[model samples]
Every structure is written in structure tokens, then in C-alpha cells.
Target: MPVVHHRCRRTEQKAEELTNARSKNRQMGPNTLLAHGPYDPHSLHGFVNPPVIHASTVLFESTDAMRHRKSLPYTYGLRGTPTTKALEDALSELEGADETILVPSGLAAITVPLLAFLGAGDHCLVVDSVYTPTRQFCNGTLRRMGVEIAYFDPHIGAGIADLMKPNTKVVFLEAPGSNTFEMMDVAAVCAAARAGGAVTMLDNTWATPLYFRPIAHGVDLSIHALTKYPGGHSDLMMGSVSATAATAAQLRETQMQIGLNAAPDDVYLVLRGLKTMGVRLERHQASALELARWLERREDVAEVRHPALPSFFDHALYARQFSGCSGLFSFLLPGGFKQAATFLDALELIGLGYSWGGHESLAVAVDLSDRTVAKGPKDGTFIRLQVGLEDVADLKADLEAGFAALAATAGTAG
Candidate 1:
């Protein structure tokens, strides 16, 4: 007879103990939950962080156990690992979701839920202000899969009910519509979708769960591009989908069947970032609001699209729904593409980048000409900025330089 190791017995005992304690720990506040809910110091020999378990094959001690792997905690790495579970649990707690699924990229988070709910002969209503990549996916892959897609104005609110088809299975939304920062009436749209028997999903990446709890506001499924706020460092790529108890089964099943998994290292990175996300986001929110206000007074700026600003058209709606804002907002410059290029080229401190939610600031020019249901800004060129942790005064000086470049370009054009 083979003797079992004492370490194995200790591990089993600790696992069982922690399993029983999870429900109690979940009742704690968000900050406590993010820091310690997912990890047990006793389980990992008093270590504060969970170990990165890079695994594919999980071995069983007995043939019977191997044959009945479905009863086990983890059967395979593609399904999940200890590292992945920690991140999922933490995210679920923050989002008020019954369960969460991790994916390779933020786009995967959006696409997976659509794939799970929609099939051939199904229709999906997507907001026109959705992320450009999401719009492309709906137009290309979902179209090829024989799913009908329609674009609706983000501000449609309760009017969304009139557009729902009998075959519509999903109503997708992104509040503070991508680039344009137009706020959607989430409760109104969600109520309308629920009446029509369509599942409601929102890309809550901008506000994250810290500032806006989507599930609490009637959203059925909440998605996050973890690459942005959750990751915080601009080094990792991951996405998460959180669902209410009633809808979690289908989402999990679809994810498993598709073999979607976030990398263990990236999962660990995100877990690390979550601890400091609260404070980092507070800084981001402050700097972004200050910059948005300053831009409103600029002669070169045509409009600022941050919802938190009192001057924003949808400020009332934003105030009603969101507890706080993040670092991202857009403004229109007084010139066309040429001036936009000049501004971008002249920036000294901010990087020209596509993604946001990093420690460093970034700037990008947006073109909304492709929008069919919503009109692009008629004033001039659209520019989006991600206000990072940099000093506000320094960032303002950088913008001054950018504006100077825009003026210089206009001078040359004349």
C-alpha cells in the first residue's frame, strides 16, 4: 500500500476549510473583498498573494477519481486554474455577479455572450455608439453566422422597445457611447429590453464596477475589457463577462465549449492591479474632470464630451446613473484631420495609443463618419484623451503645446 504524504493531507484540509469560509467572506466591503476575499493566507503558507499555477494536466491520485473528474474542483487548465479562479471570484464580488468568465481579450468578453445567446435566425440590436471593433464583429462574423444585426441610436432610451424584433435575442449597449461620450438611459433601455424578452448586455469597461454597478441597475450581463482599468498597467490583455444567476449557465457553457481562457500570468497581473485600482481610478477621475473643464474654456476646442461636466448635454442622465467617472473623455478641435494630426504629433507627454486605463496619458483622433444612426460632431475633428496619473499642470502644458501645433498647421494651410 502506498502512503499518502502529510503535505497532501494538509492541502486537502485547507481547501475544505477555505471553501466553507467563502460565503462569509463575500459579505465584506469591496476594498476588503478585492484585497483578501479570493486568497487564504493559511492555504498558501502565509503568503499574501496566490501562487501562479501554470497547468494543463491535472493528475488524480486514483483511477476512480480520474474517471469521475466532473466532480473535482478543477479538471483541466483550459477550464480554469487556481490563479484564474482567484481573479474570477474577485471580479464577481465587485460586479455583483453570480458567476464570471474570463477571456483572452476584452473583445472576446463582448463576442462570447453574443455567441451564447444568438444563433441562426436570431437578431441583435446593437447601439450605434458601441466600440468600433464590436460593430465590426457584429457586421462581419455575426452576419456570416446568419444572425441579423441592427444599429440603434444610443440615446433611444425607452424607444428601444419599438425596434425590437420578435427574433431579437440580445440588446447590446455601451453607456457614454464610444468616443462621443453620449450617455444612455440604462434603466429605461434595460426595462424595454426585458419587456421584449431580449437579454440586455452593457460594456461597463469605462466606469468599471467600482463607480457603476450595472447588475444592480437592471442590466442582465455586464462586460469588462480587463485590459483597461482592471489591468491598469497596459501590459496584460484580458476580458471578463459577469452574469446574473439566471443567465450564468448558458454563458459558462458557451465559454467552456469554445475553450476560451485567460492566460494565468495575465490573470495574476490583473489580480495584483485590482488592489490599487480604487485609488488609481480616483486620481484618474480627478485629473480627467479638471482637464475637461479646462478644455471647455479653450479657444481651439469646439466641444468637450465628458459626461461629468455640467455643460455636457447628458449630464443629468450621467449623474443619475453613475457614481463617478474614469479618465477617458473626448473633445472636438477647431480644424479637420490635418489639425488633428498636428496636435497628435506635437504632444510631448501623452502617448498616441489605442487603449486606455494605464498609468500614462494617451491621445487619439476619432472619426465617426461610419455611424449610420448617429451623426458625427459637425464642428471639426474629434479627439479623445485618457487622463492618466500625471500631474494636472504638466498635462495642461502638454495640451498647450498641442494647441500651438494645431495653430501652426492652420497657418501653413492658409
Candidate 2:
């Protein structure tokens, strides 16, 4: 007679339910799918949230079970717990990916795929306006390792093909690139990368999956900083790399080999945040667009770099690709760093900080000195703003004060 463990049977049953749910989830709207993603109340004794399983060890039923531990749901905590699986499964669904892997921070999401797909002799193409940390890693680590790195214009589009060498293994993209918010031709870049036999990866954190799904548009791996909108709060730090069927194995293998894992508690928080992501993002988009419009009209503002705004250079491209906009965007203030400092010093409600996609509004003075190309207006101070879920009227008043302070500064200089 053969023995069947209750826990193992339960795990198998749960996996089946999740697989079935994923198919049905594709039919639901983003908001509806988010609420029901991969979490079955019936399976967990009528609990709405998945249980956070803090674990490092797995108990086996017998000699056969121990010998074939690979067949089990989870072998160790570092591999994943129920909590981690819940989040990963949800992200995979949102991203329209075969699998989604977790890491400690948003930057890890970028580095993991780079490491997975590139080697010493391989060449990589990165957007000129990529996140500063990504550029730093390529210049420092990837360069030191003998990987040939090249930066390209964010708007290079299908022209990226010209830069592809025989060894170009990866082409990294960040649309509405970093602080300057320059939009890219995502589909064109991905297609060119595919034709060149190079893997394509995009930092989709700014748009989240709700606004954009990278895999559907030929991207092999869609990267996100779950610490932002997915966490919806400023408390936790985590990142995710969602991969298509072609890239999933490599992404997962690299993550496992590197022993990378997000904290169970942080994963749980992000799962909860996902349920409300749609609603929070609505407020964020509406508020940010309204603010960007107002900034564009002000005399103190030189340029507003929000893709959603019609005044933007790539507004048509942004309109064609993105269904919605996020709260993070930048504006150029007239004058230099000193003038930017004065404007920030006047802000009372918007915090002087780094990172966006939180419940609270934040602003930071951007330094584009490291950029080799696509450097923004050299004469003005670039200020990136993360519009929070604050009252739009109140946010306007705070900025009004900032402009007033600049006026006072000019008066004193005279």
C-alpha cells in the first residue's frame, strides 16, 4: 500500500486551482483580476489573504518523498514559501508572463536578468537615460568583467539594429527614461532585438503592469520595482523580474544560483497592495496630469517631462503605447542648482526625498551629469516630482509657494 501525505495532496490541489484561475484571470479586467489573483479563500479555509509561511525547511513523509524532494511545492524558504509564491503568481498574471521571480530591491530586478543573459565577451545595449544605478552597474561591474557596454538614444527605436553586434546578448530599455522621462519605441526596439537574436528587457516599474504589459509587446523580460506601486506604501523594498516562456528558465535559474529572495513580510505587503493598485493608480494619474498641466503653464517652469502631456516631445508615441500614466515625472525650473534649491526649500507638503509611488508626495532635484547622451536642459534645474494621493488643490498651493520663493530669490539677487 502506498501512503499519501495530506500536506502534499493539499499542495498539489492548490497548484491545480492556481493554474485554472490564471486562465480565467486573463478574461477579467485589471482591477477585478487584481482582487482575485492566485488567492483562493476556499483553499485556505476561507481566508481572504494567503498565509505567510515563514520557512527554511520542508518535512517529507517517507524515504521516497525525501529522495524526490524536487517534486514538492517548496524545498526551502529561500526558494519560496506560500507567501512568496502567492506574490510571484500574481505578478506573473499581471505581467502576462510565464514566470515572475523576486529579489531584494528594484535594482536587483535589473541586474539579475543582465547577469543571467550576459557574460564576459557578450555585448549589451542600454538606454542612455536608464536608471542611474543601472548605468553605474554596467560601467563598474559589467565593464570590469569584460562585457562590452554601449549606450543608445532612448528614441533610437528600430535604429537600435545598427548598434547590435554579433555578440550583443542583451538590450535593456526604460521608457520615459529615468528622471528626464523620454519615451521609447518599445515594440520597435524589442522587434529589432529579437531579429538580432538578443534578449530584450525593460524596466517597467514606472508604468507598472496595469498601465503596460511588456511581454505582450515582444519583450522577453519585464522588470519592475515592486517597492513602488505594487507595495503602494513607502515601507518595504522589493523587485520582480517577469519573463516570457523563452526566458523564464534562465531568469529563475540565475535567481536560484545567486540565492536571491525577497522577504516574506515584504512580499505579503505587496500582495495586499496589489488589491488596491488599480484604485490608487487612478488618483495618482489624475493628480499628476493635472499638476503637470499647471506646471507647464507657469513662467518659472522651463519644461515638463510627463509623457501623458500633449506638450511632451513623444506624446504621440506615449499615447500609442501606454493606456495610462504614473505619478512620477519631472519639470525643469529656470536657472541653476541654487534656484532649484530655493524652490525645494520652500516646499512644506512635498517631501525632499528619493523614490516615488507612495501614499505621500515627494520631490527631488535631479543631476544629469553622468548621462553620456540625452542630457536634459543644461541651463535649468531638473526637478522630478512623485505626485502622491494628496488633494490636487493643496498640491498646487505648495508649488505656488515654491514659485513664489523663486520670485523672492530673483528679487534678492537684483
Candidate 3:
């Protein structure tokens, strides 16, 4: 029986090596041909998709080999397989980071970086308009862990230096702050954090690595919620953190210690989604920008809160920092809750969903007056919109119906 099993193990390793070599040939990292990007041939899976691999126990060669604990490809399924590492390599190359690690979701992406860098008694300066979960985690988990989290205005920029204490360890940033779309000067924030000997991290989910490279502007780490755009089809949930060699080592170590590895299937889905992201993002950008302008011209709108728009308060900062605009934007409705609700309910094509970056449009109302400490967009009523790959004319017509509903509910002219 032992002899038979030994032969079986050898056969499996040979098969795996062939698979790994083929996969490596398909994807390129930082050194592929510039003209022809990495492209996969037609998938052989029955559904034209990569089959999900569920693995856990990875057998080793011998007791001697296992005892040394030396690196021998994938020792355990929990760490990763070729399918998973291929995705990680792809993300690392895209972001120009020395290394990348995947987490379960976008919030996981944020929390893990914070976890690796922060300890009890450390101080962290978080932007006032950061993703709400980040705030909750800081106030709830980080606070309980004895870490001090202080919220600061997104526009503080270089002035954030004032808030840094001697123990300040991290400066967390989110550009074009959630829902309200306020822009942040990443370079300015990094300058402030560096002077105080603090690490800087940002949720680069909006303008993905293709549009913005946070590390080039002095940020220590760049994070992306792959679920939104990178997983453009919305079929998978994943997050990534990419950093320079020095910082990547810390995050990688923490990722292993916390056992935060993602499933190989999720990684495969994201990798597939990433292949055509540029084209999809372009459509999303054009459609959303058109809608932002249309919203700005409406008398019912207080403002079209899109960083790509010239009328946006932080337009100049955005133009300087980013190469492209994303599908996400927000606008202030003429009337607060009553009118906003009416408009949302009257929509035909748009859905009332929590996430964006898919092939569909979504709307959500957010209020931040109570959460911000500094000049955050304290407004009457705010509504965020994610313009999908729909026709501009049809989307505009849908808005017309929504405005009519708002007018009827508020007893105002449309």
C-alpha cells in the first residue's frame, strides 16, 4: 500500500508542475511585451471559466523534507496554490508593488493593513469621510485593542501634520470620500505623515491602479477592493494590498499569521475579471461623466459631487493626481429625504444596491454631517450614483422620470 501511494504522490506532483508551468506562461509580470498584454486562450472548462479548486492538505515528499520546514512550492492549501499566486502576481504587477496579498473583501483589505502596522497604544489619523466600516472598525475593534483613532478632514492635506501625535503610526486616506465625492491630496497627506514618521495607506478602490498609483506619490501602501471594479462582473469578493518590498513583507507576515488567505476560486474569478477591466472602466467613465454633467445642469440639484467635474470643489487636486475617472459619483438633491426617496423609487433601470462597479447602475443616500470633524460636505441631502454601461440617453430619460416624481412629492416645479 505504501509503495502504491508513493507512486500516486509522484504522479500528482508531475501533473501539478505541468499545470503551473502552463499558467506561468499565460501571465506576465512587470516584464511582458508592452504591445501585447497577457491574454489567455479559450478556457477549456465546460462553462468557458476556470474551475474552482478546493484544497487544504498538501502532501510533502518525505519526513526529512517536512522536518526542515523549507519552502517547497505550496506546503499547505491554506497558504496558496498556483491559481491563487498567479492572481497575486497579476495584482502586484498592475499596482507596481513588490508584493500583494488578497483578503476576503474590501473592508478586509483596509483592516488587515491597519492590523499589521498598528499595535496597542498607537495613534492613527483617519480621514473624516473614510469608508464607514473603516470608522466602525477603528471605533469598535481598534479602540478596544487600545489603539487611538482620530478622524480628520480629507482636505486637511499637509495640514494634517498638526493632528499627528508622537505615537501616531498610520495616516489612512480615501480619495473622493465616500458618497459625497470629496477629493483628497494624497501627496499632501503623505508629506504630512512622512514628516511625523507615520505610514500612509489609502483605499484606491475608486480610481484603480490603472488610473492612480498611490505609492508613486509617497504613500506607503495602496489598497483596492477588487470586488467593485477589478471584479467588474460582481461575481467574486476580493481585496488586495500592494506595497514596496519593505512594507510588503510586514503585510505578508501578518496575513499569514492571521490566516487571512482567500479561496483560490475567488482569486481566479478576479483574475478573469481583470483581463478586460480597461475597456469596461472606459464605458463606466464616459457614462457616469455624462450623468454627472446632466445632474449639474438640473435646477433641482444643489451640486454634482463628482471629482472629475470642473465644478467639483477638489477638481484641481483630482486632475493633478489621477489619470482617469471612475463610474461612482454623488449629487445633492434639491429636497432632502422626502424628495430623494421619491426620486429613487421612481427609477426604472437603476437599482438601490449597496455596491457599484458592476454592469448596473445603483443609488444610495448618505449623510455625513454628524461624522465629520472638519469641513466635510455638510449638506442638505446627498445621493451617490454608480453609472453602469447603459446608454446615456436611456439613463437620462430614467432620471427625467425620477425628477418628475421628486417634483410631485415635493409640490415643486419639475
- Give all candidates' CA lDDT scores: 0.91, 0.92, 0.82
Best by lDDT: 2
Give every collision pair in model 3.
none
Q: For residues 231-286, could you state the per-residue lDDT of candidate 1 as single tens digits?
A: 99999999999999989999999999999999999999999999989889999999
Candidate 3 overall lDDT versus native: 0.82
Model 2 poorest 10 in a row by lDDT: 1-10
Q: Best to worst by TM-score, what's the order?
A: 2, 1, 3
TM-score of each: 0.93, 0.95, 0.87
In angstroms, give how far residue 374 of model 1 lies from its true place: 2.0
Runs in model 2 deviating more than 4 A are 1-25
lDDT by residue (tens digit), candidate 3, 246-295: 79989988998999888887887787777678788889999999899988
Q: After superposition, how far is residue 223 of candidate 2 from its true place, in Å?
A: 0.5
- Give the clash count for model 1: 0
Colliding pairs, model 1: none
The alpha-carbon RMSD values of the candidates against the true structure, listed in the order shown, are: 2.9, 3.1, 5.5
Question: What's the CA error at residue 408 for candidate 2, in Å?
Answer: 0.5
Candidate ranking (lDDT, best to worst): 2, 1, 3
